[model samples]
Target: MKISDIASISDAQKFILDLYPNDNRDFSYVFGYATRHLGYLCKSLCKNSPSVEEFIRSISWLLALANKLEVDVEVSLIKRHPDICPYCVVAPCKCRWTGKKPAIGIKAYKIPEELFYRAEQIKREKKADFQSHCERLAIIYPGNAYKWDAIGPWQLTSKMQEELAEVHEAATRYLSGRKSIDAVAEEFADLFAWLLSAWGLSFPEGNVDDSFIEYYLAGCPVCGNNENCECELFADLSTQLVDSDKIKELEKLFLALSSEVGFDGDEVSEVLQSLEAASKSQSEPVARAAVDQAKAKTEELEKLVERGAKNAKNATTIAQAIYKAIENFPFVG
Candidate 1:
């Protein structure tokens, strides 16, 4: 935090090296992990910024944070930079820029959403060795956020709202007759992921890179890669997600963990935070409180919790998650 501390930081790797500077391997591992976390935090904060200038400032601070830690994020990118964003690229960039709007130079590099979804599924179902290879190279490059966790529903909400709602509609249709809560949930979450993108918040951790490459190149010069890159996004990502109320709700999640008997983990914390942030922007204080109550009851006996069960029914965040759970099996005491 101090200016001196800020200046002393080096490449993300070096800053990490300082943590355990003597133990070479451990130093590298911890630094990479820490930088990864920092990246996610930076990406998160960037969404809170209102203007592009402010966004740039947000990023600069992240770079400085990496510097104080001593990371050469630049060289790291040069060595391992991804040719194409493996997550949301419609066309593998030919690395050309004559201003804006790239004309798909090569058809081979392009993929439609249908095929893209199929490829994504195949990667998920990859053979052990193949999967390992992908995972192994994951943290080390142009960012593997897309490969497995590629299709972030919340992150890609806009594109999904534009395209995937049909899937959710179909799911809703299925639920009308069969009443499978889980099915409804799957579709809702899938559609939600895409819808949330319109808000700039994402379901999964949206990451940032602290590599020196960020300091110099900013993004992959070849492709439109930046902290704001849509490829890094889960959908046709926008950058305007913010809600003090949701943030307030997220703090309540710690209480959710303590209040709930058996459902708490960093994963749950992160998921709860994302869901709250991605909800429509309006401060419904009473509704918020009721939603928290439902979350607390979730692990207990919830019985046929239907629409308007209480003020909670109106809290979209709680209602969606709870209804999905209760749709088929409402927690009953």
Candidate 2:
């Protein structure tokens, strides 16, 4: 299914364009180097992380930055699904670690972090929420579905960090290796695209067009593949099993929730709270009310553009929403 590995995508292009970092391509390796450096940085930054909750929260903060950029990090795991490399289709993927073929399912290693592996571990138990068709992906590329556990804060080694720095420098040179001096910086930005992906961050958002997936998920960030900007995206995370009713409630206040892009990190902790509200308000009233609210919002947007309302175009849609609401209020001066 891996859409990214097979063909280019729209969202991916929008992502890369936004990440314009330099003028050249040779220096793009800095992104790859950042990948290796992250583990060490994460280890140090999360040293005081008490429980998995603390760890997930820290990671969510990182996720906030990712969401703003539209990186589609799920594609990162799919791109690196070791099944193709080791041809292993099972948990632990012993073939990757041991370089040996397995009999039935591939054997694997002991993942380090308790938090990151939470999803993967659940997957290992056949409990990951998935579709009947997704099971096919499991059959053909059957193994751990996600990369969270394999890449924990404490999972990387010291030698990896040293090598990452070297890779960063190499990528830098590649960006401007043959191009004009000004082009080097462009290359650096490209490489940074890879670095962010490796960090499980979304690829840059500006790349969202015909050429995005290709640029963001490019197989080789350094050598410059002949298949440049041709990566594919198999699934859309927005459509996946994250409990929509919950998301709708969040989506209802979505304007409000988007206090930060998608939703505020602070509000993420209140996800369960929102979910409970969703369950209680399953009647048509909540949904009908939401539809009415959304319609009102759309009409407001049209008014702003139509009238060229002062301080409107300069404001975000949500800001405009608030502004319009205030205007409609009948409070006494």
Candidate 3:
């Protein structure tokens, strides 16, 4: 089924469960993997890289955790954000200038046919960046005074981190008999809310359900085989070593050329990360394809550099070409 057909958070949770029906992982293991992917999202955000894939992967794990713990994610979300700003009680949310802190309780509302649609509505109405969405949501839901104190990317990320830890702790407590499974589910709900907030803040344009469906409709992304995923066991350390060394050499050359063209270190670093991510496949054909793509990118870079590289934008374009070449080279590492 399409992800848009997922009528509520509960439905999304079930979709994730169906995706990995035989998954015997415990809560800690699931949470750890989710956290790792979330770290990837943070790294991408810090580097100004597009993080749509990272965000979707992280949410999938969290949804799995929610399903495992039987979290009423739908109610949790609707209660906190009932189609309007819970704090200002407005659709568009004008809390920035008004500085209003209305003591609003969670109001009940009929859940939408598609929960993600609510996020899309907010994105269109605000017409602001992701951080603005986080600010509005943070102010409305839970009504934390500290959240409004410093509304920025860092603050939102910090809140997400805090919620992540709480989810972990709650899970630990449940495992140790210190808390009920319901308590863990409650924490999961909080984490899911923060995750949605992060999604809104990071990706303000596209529908997440659409992206999720498109990405996963074709079985596993890594191994491209749903029946038995051997991606982790299929590693070739020797190939990896050779590729790593080659990448380091290419990185040095790219950096030197970028510096010669007056490009800053950050732009070069971002491109290098993208290239590294792209060239991680162990298959010989994919590796060869990556090498060919890298050579082409190097040629492009040479041309761009020779033809009056005036700004970092020119360097960025070259870097992007290298990244695309790497990404299109297919293989599972």
Candidate 4:
């Protein structure tokens, strides 16, 4: 899919699946890739590079992990943030000023009302998407008010690193029965937002969505596989392929699937694209077309439908295997 078509967080997840499906990778493997790219991002920032490419790479891996885990990151973001500061539960967070102070350090601030009424109202009325969440965060924490100019790139990245550490800590606590899974999820959401903020700081004029799609235009930059990356060892990839014909073909298929099946056409197209990217012999489009043929009351439609069902079942089984493999995997960043 092209950059312009991505409108929600699920779209981003599907993009990752297209590039790196749950073929042979486990949850821990994907998690390692996420942290590995995050390390690269920190190095990039430390060296004062103008590129935010590593940041997007890290986000792509994180999305993959979330997909495997069946975590709806958009829903998690909406529940935790809801267009406001999660801790303060208000736009332009007042936790520093309006909330009570129980201590004298960074974790001192505490929300007066744990049940945020306004947050609930906003969640009910607002439709959460990745772009809108980023926009809402910009408003809730305006750069001008937050001294975005004063905070250098290194500082922003430092905050990202700090959030990563907190994610580790939260996971540790959860393992020890001191914290909940939601706490770990919250840390992840915070880290993602911070990554977006750092990207904005690095390239004020660049669009994250467009840049992301452009980076993965030909799938894994290193291995050049759209799905099931073949890179066994870490490698740097500078090549980016642009195939307008492929894009046009995928777009046409998406439109066709939208009319054929009652599923989200973009998602189904992405699934097919993943198979095509890996050069799988099984033709998903053919199977789906047979689905249409089955609608015509053909005699052999039952066999076609069974094949499609098996493919669908295999996909789910692979996803479940990945999930179980990494369900207890710890954050290693």
What is the per-residue lDDT of model 2 for residues 1-333, given as tens digits with 9 covering 90 to 100? 122432222223323333322224222232432352355344533342222222222222222223333343333233233223223434444565545554344234432122235435433544211121123233333232243245433332233344345434543454447434223332322332223222232212222222323333443233433433332322112211233454354344434523323333443434434444534665444433433454444444445445654444433565455445333321201
Q: Poorest 10 consecutive residues of model 1 by lDDT?
A: 1-10
- Which one is best on lDDT? 4
What TM-scores do the predictions have? 0.19, 0.25, 0.56, 0.57
Report each candidate's C-alpha RMSD, comma-separated, in the order given: 21.6, 19.1, 11.1, 19.3
Colliding residue pairs in candidate 3:
none
Global lDDT of each candidate? 0.34, 0.34, 0.58, 0.58
Model 1 TM-score? 0.19
Better of 2 and 3 by TM-score: 3
Local error of candidate 3 at 117, Å? 22
Could you tell me how far off, in angstroms, the CA of residue 127 lies in candidate 1 after the best superposition? 47
| Candidate 1 vs candidate 4, lDDT winner | 4
Q: Which tens-of-lDDT digit does each residue in 1-333 have in candidate 4?
A: 434566667678777776666766765666676777787787766666636567678788778866665566776666666666765555676666756332222342344233245457656886455556666667766643255566556666778778877876776676679988777777878887877766766666677766777787776777887655677644554212223333334334433433333344344555445435422333334433422332222222223334563454443443344334222121101
**CA shift of 170, model 1, Å:** 44
Q: List residue ranges in candidate 2 displaced over 4 A.
A: 1-13, 19-40, 43-79, 82-89, 96-99, 102-153, 157-333
